[model samples]
Target: MCGIVGAVAQRNIVPILLEGLKRLEYRGYDSCGVAVNNGGLKRARSVSRVAELERQVDDSGFAGNTGIAHTRWATHGVPATNNAHPHFSARDGEQRIGLVHNGIIENYEEIRTELKALGYVFESQTDTEAIAHLVNHMYDGDLLSTVQKAVKRLHGAFAIAVFAKDEPQRIVGARLGCPLIVGLCDNENFLASDAMALAGSTDQIIYLEEGDVVDVRLDGVRIYDRDDQPVERRVQTVQAYSGAIELGPYRHYMQKEIFEQPRAISDTLEGVLGFAPDLFGPKAQDVFADIDSVLILACGTSYYSGMTAKYWLESLANLPTSVEIASEYRYRKPAVNPKALVVVISQSGETADTLAALKYAKELGHRHSLSICNVGTSAMVRETELSYLTRAGAEIGVASTKAFTTQLTALFLLTATLAKMRGKLDAEAEAFYLKSLRHLPTALQSVLALEPHIIAWSEAFARKENALFLGRGLHYPIALEGALKLKEISYIHAEAYPAGELKHGPLALVTEEMPVVTVAPNDTLIEKLKSNMQEVRARGGQLYVFADGDSQMSSSEGIHVIRLPEHYGLLSPILHVVPLQLLAYHTALARGTDVDKPRNLAKSVTVE
Candidate 1:
């Protein structure tokens, strides 16, 4: 994945390009570059951060209305200054154009061979550079027509921005299977990989649909179909605190996001409880009021949210519910029907595989699809007939924190509403679940106050190369999420196993060097998980556990404990996940790894 941003402003372009690249650095940071057309065309590249690119541009003082910049993630070429993007091509004596591209071109090899056959010499080892050359070769003196034709010949996922020498007044942008957004301003126009890049400059934007191209300039903005006919679209305003994108006073985004969970939960619950006609537990039952089956699909941490929801859906709703990882859902032909409700869960709402599964399900004739997503106006939100919003704000961290809890919160509320609709909930039953649900915000506050302990424990995991996590029932899926977070950010080799399955195969990996993290709360699985913890100790495996505060513990057993609050029920997984998130964040911090932008990991996966 890579980040692309372009600004054709009324004033200097270098400053806006620089600031925009820095804002998009989360999408990619391996290398960066910028191309500008002042009096003459100039391009700058850097192997380090965006600052180096800015420095070179400042030294050259290249400024123009039409310019393109890129923060590259190094997919096709090595991470080096030369491989950095805003790639360019010149016709030796006639024309030149700079290009910044996102997404992989699967047929680049074939196109490269064809270009060479036509006697065109190549420079860099990038699929994007080929795009510039192809545009130049196919140009008939019209930038828009040339780009439209060249893009028609290309195949695979790509979103590209082009700045031409002859067309100095306008910027050309197009997308197919990758993300691109056009931001409109009174005196300028912009094309960026995402709306966040244009946050300071403009809030009104039109998301470029697949196979669509746009020419943006100070005087006008025009969209065209693949056939080059001009089309019109209404612009939508972005909804977010412009300041929320900034780090504020925090040292890192992970820490800032962790502290924001209290408010994030509240915001998600805002207008949900009273004013929104029971968003948490309402309308869900109406849709599934007579349904006899349920299927949910999700990926990564969101999958854990689905797994927790499965438990509540089965217990509370008394419905046969199944949760499948998106990838696996495809290979196995699961039972489905018009009466079944399919749920898709994602934080960014752009996860490639999950979106694909949702699309596939829709094509297979399941129209009653529901999506639980954090971001509004996402493709997933648009695809689903029904959507539940998660209150977590912009999550810059590659590993999610607040989004996970909020998804579980929404899922649990759905379950309660389903149970109420199914006539399974009595007043006492409703009151019990509702009271526990109400106490969650305070419970989260308590867990957040325990951060000092998490920070201390992180020191051990920072040096640890391998670890294992264990849980059962709802927490089993959360255990998997915990291990994934550790492996993703901290670079620790970690695995998760159900406590009951310890004797199967994973138990063999148990050693004193491997810390066995058991998510043991005072639930039905407590006794069984305690037995599993002892089995690990018998094998000289060190134990680190999150146990209920009132649970019994023995110092002789050497089971280090993280005392949790008193609300242990179906909703406990939501709380149990907080420590693991903290542990993973602090551990990655101690290891000195990039917590917000993990290597080879993008904040949002927009391509399959």
Candidate 2:
């Protein structure tokens, strides 16, 4: 995935474009570039961070009233200056059109061959360059119509913004599968892949639908549908978190989000007097009643959350639950059940694979759908019939922290609601669960206090190249998440297994050099997990255990233990995950790796 931002303002838009790119840096940071319609087309490109590109713009004194910018996460080509966005289409040795794109062009090879036949020379090896050349070929003095025609010939997902040297003060944008928003301001209009990029500049935004093309000028904006018919879209006022985006008193966004878990869980649980079906939506009761099973569709960290929910939904609600990786769900021929509830979990809600899976489930006659998402304006929220908005503000870190915990909080509430609805939980049991949830914020605070201990462990872990995580029963998915976090941020090779499976195969990989991180909650599986730990000790493996305060496990010899403040019954997973997040953050810090923007990863996965 990449980020795109465009502006049609009378004022010099160089600063605005650069600032917008900075806000969207989480989406992409491999390379960045900007192109402006100055005297002709002035441009700056960098195969580095946006801050370096900004310095280049400042050194060159580049200024333009209309411009387009992009920050890229390398897809088609390597992260190089030649492959960066704001790609140009030249004719007669002069650049005519400049474009910034956010998705893949599947049929680019065909288009590139056709363009070469037309005597157009290509510069970069990116699929996006084909779009620029095609747009240039289709131009008939109308940039908007040309973009619309060019997109028709292209295949696969895309959201693009284009500006031409011949069309001053005019910019054209189109959205097919990726997200593109129009920010409405007085006498000036802006375009960005995400609304947060235009946070302070404008609150009013128009979310473009699929196959919609927009013509933006200093005076106004005009939109057209896929069939080339004039259409109007709703403009909503979104409260962009301009202040929360700042890293105040924190080393990185991952660390800040790791510490924000308590507050994020509290905000996500706000207004929950008690669990009820309507907490999701007005139609949730009917939908939940009709569904006999739940099929959770998600990817990456969100997929781990869904895996955690599968345990709750099956054990507490007495329902069959299945978790599928969103990217693979549609590719397989799954037995469709019309009564099954399709629950899609995503932090950004714009994750391309998850969104496609949700639509695929709907296509197979699954009527009941629910979305657990952080962004209220995201496509997943708009598409699903029932939804829970996790108030885990803007997650700037490529490795998720607050979003994961908040999703657990929401899924726990969903479990309670379903259990009560199905008569599996009585009034007294419901009250006890609610009280446990109410105590969660305080419980989370105590877990955060263990950061000092986790930081200490990270020092040892940072030197290791491999790790193994162990958990049993309901906590197994959390171990997977822990391993994912370590590998994602610290670049460590990590693996997780149900504690019993250690002896089957994973135990052979255990040795003194392999640090085994165990999630030893004080549950029914505690003794079995202890046996697993003894097995590791017998094999000369070092142990790092996150145990419950009352688990009675302590640091001795090769085994190390850091007890959590409380044994939170069914809700212990939420608390145990926080320490793992802190461990990953501190480990990344010790290893001198980028914690917020890990290598070869973007915060929001908008492309498959």
Candidate 3:
């Protein structure tokens, strides 16, 4: 998940480029660099943070009116100064081309062999270096045409920004599989992998489509389609949330986001008055009428949200459902039902594997597709026939909190809509579900009040090396999510298993040193879950349980219980997950780890 920013402007662009990279830092990166054309290609790169790169630029007196910058998440080489972005293509002892790229090149080995045979030498172990050399080799007095011809030979996904030493006032950009956007300002033009990079600088943004090439100049911009035909793209105005990116009173973005859940769910359910198929889209009524089953596709946290929805959809809507990891779904041929409604979930909507899976599903003749996402203008939204936009705002934390809850809120709405369409819900049932949804914000507030108790538990957890999470029935996915959050931010080895599955194998790993966390909602499985807890306690395993107020669970010699305010029967997963998030957050803080920007992880997985 790399980031790219480029600008053709009249003023010094180094500050703008550096600030853009800062905004994109949440996407995750290992190294950063910038290249400027001040009569010649002047570049600086570092494997350290962006702040260090800025210091190096200032010390070297680096300044330019036109430039390209990159924050790279390494895929082809090790994270080192040489592997950093803004890679160069030198000719006759002069760096002629400076290029920054996102995404991978599948046929780089073949291209590199051909380029090497043509006497082109590579200095970095990256697939992107091949593109730079190919561009330099194809330069015939025009940077735009040279890049256009070079990208035609590329075999895999890429979004690139390149500047030529001879064409100091111009920058060429192209996108195939990854995202790219153009920002418009007075006598200035910009290119970035994300519109957030140009938030304060420009409000007018143009999202480029697949296989589009853009040429940016100080006065204007030009675009070309895949077939070499000149084209015009619509420019839309975007309101930048300047205040949302700041950490106000909160220690980290993760903490602020965790506290923001109540408002996020409220915003996501803002306009809902009652259940209706049209809540999803204008065509939802027809789509719901035709579908016989549901197929959910996603990855990581989104996949877990789908797993929770499986219980909601099957039990409430009486529809058969299946959830698949998006990355694995596209690799093998599977039975595709033409009538099955395909639902894809993601927060950023730019997740590479999920987007690819959506395309693959369409190619396999799936007639109906829907996207539940936070970003309204993302590629997944554009590719699908219907979409539900979750108003979770901007999730800056690499470990998701508000986004995950907001997704569950959206999926629940979908379940209710389908239930209503199938005539399974009468007036009384509809009113009850609506009242429960309206009261979710208040319920979430009550759960947040339990943070002080969770913080006390976090101290004991921070000293441990491993954790085990258990749940039954509908809460099993919540247990998986809890384990994922613990391992993701706190860097602790954690695992989750269904309560019934513990005796099968996971119980052998239980001991006094292991902390077993359980989600005990007051559901039909409570008695069965009690038996599972007995098994854990009998094995001398320390237990930390999050139970509903009426579950009748209490703290004892080896058992530590934190009671939730109430039991939300159908929506308990959404409420049960908040404490686990807090447990992970405070644990990471106690361990002195980077809670916001965890090591080796990015907020958005834009590349496979």
Candidate 4:
């Protein structure tokens, strides 16, 4: 996935383009470039960060009222200056167009062959470069018509922004499977792959649907459908704040987001004094009445959240539930229960595989669909009939922290609401659940107080090459999440197993060199989990147990313990995950690895 930003304004728009790209750099940050239509065309490309792109532009002293910029996470080409975006198309002496694109163009090779036969030569090894040449070849001095024609010939996911030197006051954009938006301002107009890029300049945004072409000018904007008819789309205001992207006094975004858990969880639980079906959406009660089972679709951290919710949905609501990795779910033609409720979880709400999986579920005759997401304007939210928005503000870290916790909070609320509707909860039981939720912010703060202890463990963990995490019941998903964090940020090879399943196979990997992180939650499975820890000890493995105060596990010869203040009952996963996040962050800090933008990972996986 890549980030694209375009601007057409009465004043110079170079600053706006650069700042917008800076905000959207979390989507992709391998290389970046910007093209400006200043009388002729002026461009600067970089093989490094956005700051380097800005410096290159400054050193060249480029300025224009119309511009398009890109920050790329390389897919078709390697990360280099020539492979950077804002690709150009010019004849021997003629300059006509420059384009920035997000998403893959599946039919580029075929088009490139035709263009090459027609006397067009390519300068870079990118699918996006072909688009610029094709648009230039089809240009009849009408940029809108040319872009519309070029998009029709292409096949695959794309959100493209194009600018012509002849038509310097206009920018044309088109979208198919990826996201694109038009930002409205007083005397200016903007386009970006994400609405978060427009938060600083304008909150008013119009989301472009699939196969919609947009023509933006300094005065206004016009939307066109696939059949060349004009269409009117409603403008919506985005609630995200620009300040959330700032990392105030923190070393990395993961650290800042980890510390923001209390506020993020509180914002997610704002108006919920008691549980009700309307907490999700107006149609939630009716949907819950007909569905006898639940099927959750998600990927990466969101999939783990779905796994955690499967536990809650089955144990609390007494409903059958299944979780599937979205990428794998979409490919296999599995048996589907028509009455099952399909729930999709995504932090960005734009993950391509998850969206495809949701579509597949709907095509298989599942009528009711719901999305648990963070972004309101994303494709998943638009496709689902009912949805719950997680209020975790802009997550800049490639490794997720607050988004996972907030998803758990929202899913827990969904569980309680479903339980109430099914008559599984009495008035006193509902009141107790509400009270526990009200106390969650304080409980989270208490867990955050254990960071010093986690940091000490991280110091020793930094020296180790591998780790094993063990848990049972609902806490098993929490252990999976912990291992994922360590591998994502710290680059430590880690594996997680249900404590009962260790004897089946994973126990063979345990040794003195392997640090075994155990989640002993003082619940019904505590005895079984403790026995698993003993299995690790008998094999000469070191133990780091996050146990409850009354579990009686302490610092012994081979056993090390950090006892929590109190056990949080059903909400223990929400509390137990904080220290693991801290462990990953501090361990990455000790190992001198890039914590925020881990290698080969982007904050949002908008491509398949």
Candidate 5:
């Protein structure tokens, strides 16, 4: 969960690498370092921001034609300078083979033991150091082959960018599970863990798949598969903008992203909008005709979107649908037919568990797999046979708001198309939901206007340490998402219970200090959610209710009611999620936490 970027630029590579690292800081910010070899051997490392690291390089007058850098989120040790990356191994672990790693190393213990046995003492607690030594152990001084052999001994999800002293002109990168992008420029080339890392430099990028190793030099790059066979891949055009990924005009990335929802929703609806009436050109249903069931595997907010999709697919498409948390889905044997169609939903497309679940589904003999993801060139999209891309541009916030809504929007459209195929829906029922879905952006805009109200209520939450979110039916997933967003950003101990499951165990935790959020919008499940709220209220838990504006439920004396616009059938979750997103954002902001680059958290989890 770190950001790694390397560049061989026409100009001084240090400045370009620093610019890229600054853009990619949202991925990680614990520490930053860079190593560039211009005319001679020069190394720059620092314990602070990328700017400070750049300043150190400038002060030392270190310049290089080729370089690799890392912005870190510490997982192995304290977020200190010693633990920072660009760990070099030459004479006495000084500056020999410069290495920066982005994923976890699972075999670090065993490798560390062996390295110790080989008289290699470690500098930092990072698993990456072992890799630096492993490369040294494997390098019979061949930069490319050494990296290949070094990667062969390592296991886990990792994207490593290495620069050797001998091969000052070359940078070798290897991908095990983490996402990697190699971009082309006029007389220059770049390597990043994600396409967004190089969003400013180029739009054409070649996405590296699992077990792909690339040797990048001044003018060319060669990719090799796991078995050492040379492979050729194409550069795909990526849709990205300089400002879309920039930290424009906002106090924090979470806040900037929350306000970007209106535009994000619109962007996600592009191309697919105004075409749902003629969507998929009448052959859409036939495309999914062989499907028996849809097993949606996702994690976090994407999992909640899958939950809502399950309701839509079964209710609209009349197909049996099962939504599973990607973390738990593979542990148990699932009841699915060989003809079952598995749909994996992920925003980053590199979510570790969701990607694993997709692979597990394929191993189960599912003939077809589809990925519903926002990012265009994510591992999830590349690995799946059929896929639907949600045009929700780069979602940087760790607490996913727009991506979840967009994924739901795409899945809802898919449900409608399938319903039309199964002959389950005629004109009336079909047009109603699709038209309602098209208006979701406007409805979501209406909900976005409630941000100030949610922010006001957030003041009461900044002091609370725990929160309970409750909803039933479709709203249950909304509750889960709310809880997730709150916990992810605010660091609050939040829990979501299936309203019915309150009495089972969660009710015992209710207290005056614990804020209980009830998603009680006027739906068939309102009364049920109300009963759950009463259970919490009777137990002295602070109640904060988000209900429909049209509902006559009088505002409780002490409880906060975040009034919602008139409730629509299925678009309610899409609209209701806005306030929760704002609540989490404002709450985290109030706490003065690093809301965007939370500790030990990266935007994309490329490793399982």
Candidate 6:
């Protein structure tokens, strides 16, 4: 993933560009740079943070009213000063054109070969440099037309911002697969890959559709379609609070976000006073009546959320549900049920594979679509007919915490709504569910109080090389999520398995050196789960269980149990995951790993 920001204003905008890049640091970046047309194109690039790039800009005395900046997550080349963004194209000895890009150019090899044959020597090993060279070769004096023609020949997902020395008062941007937006102002205009980058500067934002080009000028902005037709896009007011970007007292954003779950889940469930068929949207009743099956599309933690919902949907809503990994779902030719509702779940709402999977399902004539996402301006929300916005605010940590729980809250609501539509939820049941929903924040508070105990467990986990997580039925997804979190941040080898499947294959790997973490809520499967625990004990496997208070589990011998405040019967997963999250957080903290920005992982997966 990468970030782009461009501005054309009356005053020097290098500070604005740098600030925008700083806001985009959450998206993850390997290198960063900025290009400003001060008399000529003055650019500075560094394979470091935006702060380092800011110091370089200050030292170089680079100032201009029109400019473009980029924070790149390298895909095509190694992250170096030469491979950084704001790549320059020189004619003779002067830098004539500058370009910054997000996403990959798939056919850059062919284009690079052609440009090489034309005697355009390349200076960097990047697909973006190919675009810079191609644009410089096709500069017909009009920056907009030149970019439009050049992009017509390119392939794959790209959001590009290009500026020329001759057109110092303007910046041209084009988008295909990746996201791009235009920010409106009185005497200035802005372009960025995300609207959050423009939150403090402008509230009025225009989300550009696919294959749209925009010419940002000092006075106004012009939008064009793919076929050279001028178009008007609706400018929506972004209601994001920029204060959420700050880390107040918490050690890391992940810690702050973990504590924010109470408010985030409360916000996500604010409008729902009681369970109704229309809780998701106006068409939920009809969609539920028409579809007898559900197809959930998601990735990473979102996919696990979908998997948890599958249990809820089949049991509570009485609907047949199937969950698929979005990346694999799009590529495989699977059976498409015409009466199935395709539910897409994503925290960013811009996950490339999940979006493609949604589109692919629609292309197969499965028309019913819904998205449970946090961002309202994301492509998943824009493309889907039915949408639920999870008010989790902005999740900056690479290992998502609040976003995951808030999404689970939304998915549970969706399940209850569908159940009410199918007459499976009576008045008494609906009232119980509503009370549970209303009490989630309080339940989460009780769980957060157990952080000290979980931190003790994490002390033992931090020194371990491998771990095993076990659960049955509904809690199985929670175990998977716990394993994912431990591996993501702590870099420990972890795996999860259904308790009944221990004898299948995973039991062979159990040892005294490995810790076994179990989600042991009081449920129908508790007896079987206890039997599974005995098997683990027989093999000398140390056990760490987050059990319900009424589960009668104790801390003895090889078994270590942290009892829950109470067993929250259908909503137990929501509370059970909190301790596991704290476990992962404290474990990573003890290991001295980068808890916020995990290595080789970005917060948002914007590209496939």
- Candidates in order, TM-scores: namely 0.94, 0.99, 0.99, 0.98, 0.94, 0.98
**Residue lDDT tens for model 5, 1-608:** 58888987657788878888877876666788887866544666677888888778778877777988888887888888888888877666455777899889999999999988988868899999999988877778788888888898887889999877777678899998788889888877889987767876888889887899998976878899999899999888885656766577887767877777777767766776432424433433444777877888888778889998888888777899888899898777876587777889888888888888888888877877778888767888778767777777776766677778778788877787777767877888866875786677777778888887888889999999999998888888898899998888889989888898999999999988888888887988777777887888888888888889887676665577878887887768887777888888889889988788776677776666
Candidate 1, residues 374-432, lDDT tens digits: the string is 97877787778678899687877778888988898888767776777777787788778
Worst 10 residues of 5 by lDDT: 274-283
Query: Going through the candidates in order, what is the number of backbone clashes in each?
Result: 0, 0, 0, 0, 2, 0
lDDT by candidate, in order shown? 0.82, 0.93, 0.94, 0.90, 0.81, 0.92
* Model 4: per-residue Cα lDDT over 1-608, one tens digit each: 58989999988899999998888877757889898998998899998788988888888888999999998888888888898989989976777899998889999999999999999888789999999999999999999999999899999989999999899889999998889999999989999998878777999999998899999998899999988799999999886569978888998889999999999999999999888888888998899899899999999889989999999999899989999999999999989898888999999999999999999998989999999999988999999978999898888888899999999999999899888888888899899988888888888888889999899999999999999998898988999999999999899999988999989998899888999999899999898888888898999999999998777777998898998888988888998888888988999999999888777778888878
User: In candidate 5, how many clashes are counted?
Assistant: 2
- TM-score result, candidate 2: 0.99
Error of 3 at 322 (Å): 0.6
Error of 4 at 253 (Å): 1.7
Q: Please give the RMSD of candidate 1 to the true structure.
A: 2.3
Q: Where is model 2 poorest over a 10-residue stretch in terms of lDDT?
A: 20-29
- Candidate 1, position 574, lDDT: 76
- Deviation in angstroms for 494 in model 3? 0.7
Candidate 1 structure, TM-score to reference: 0.94
- Residues 1-608 of candidate 3: C-alpha lDDT, one tens digit per residue: 79999999999999999999988888889999999999999899999899999999999999999999999998999999888999999889888999999999999999899999998988889999999998998998899999899999998899999999999889999999999999999999999998889989998999999999999999899999998799999999977555677999999999999999999999999999998888889999899999999999999999999999999999999999999999999898989999999999999999999999999998999999999999988999999989999999988889999999999999999999899889888889999989999899999999999999999999999999999999999899999999999999999999999999998999999999999999999999999999999999999999999999998899998999999999999999999999999999999999999988888998888888
Please, what are the lDDT tens digits per residue for candidate 6 over residues 175-264?
998999999999999999988788889989999999999999988999999998999999999965678789999998888999999999
Better of 5 and 6 by TM-score: 6
Model 3 lDDT, residue 525, Cα: 95
Candidates arranged by lDDT, highest first: 3, 2, 6, 4, 1, 5
